[model samples]
Target: MDSSDREVRDVNNILFGGFTELFCLFLFLVSAFFPNSLLAGDLVEQWTGKHTRIAWVQDQGNGLDTYGRSPDLMLYGYDSQDGRGARPLLTQKSNFFKPLITP
Candidate 1:
């Protein structure tokens, strides 16, 4: 109504808008770092006797097309990086680790 009241309202609106924008940006940033906790199904049984780590990367769309639907690349190797009888084992892509995994 009055000039003073209008000025105060405008300032309040500006502050609110800025806060909303900041909160949204913060949430976006947080989500970028969040892990994709969802997996298609249980591969635990298939993982028997194999020592591996499953890395779930959250898609921040940072210029790389991480083929999300593609099968996970399983890298099998010795338990130790460099030690006695420690060596990186390579497997064929098609019949992969059939000899290693199977007894």
Candidate 2:
């Protein structure tokens, strides 16, 4: 209606939208840590498919440059590029999307 009313509405909209987004993000991060133990065997099998093990590698040090120094278990049959046998390297990138350039 009035200018002041419109401004109030805009502010409320922004606040509510930001809160909703932050809430959703929090839920997503929390869910990531909480494994679905109730998941059925068939469902889990379907998602896992041929791959049985999923290995996650985290950077021990800070900074992007530390990525090179990160532990590489490729020699242990956990490499996507040089992956051998039944289990492949289960990096975060490979799990979600196919790598553009793999060795």
Q: Which is the leading candidate under TM-score? A: 2
- Flag regions of model 1 displaced more than 4 Å: 1-12, 36-103
Model 2 earns a TM-score of 0.26
lDDT of 2: 0.36
Q: Residue-wise lDDT of candidate 2 within 21-49, one digit each (tens)?
A: 56334433433443333232233345435
lDDT, candidates in the order shown: 0.34, 0.36
Error of 1 at 66 (Å): 31
Q: All predictions: root-mean-square deviation over Cα?
A: 20.6, 14.4
TM-score for candidate 1, please give it. Answer: 0.22
Residue 67: error of model 1 in Å?
A: 35
Which digits, one per residue and each the tens of the lDDT, describe model 1 over residues 1-103? 5797688668867867686456335433433443221111112213333332222223233424233322333333322112212122443222222222223
Specify the highest-lDDT model's number. Answer: 2
Backbone collision count in every prediction? 0, 0
**Deviation from native of the Cα of residue 82 in model 2, angstroms:** 26
Query: What's the CA error at residue 14 for candidate 1, in Å?
Result: 3.8
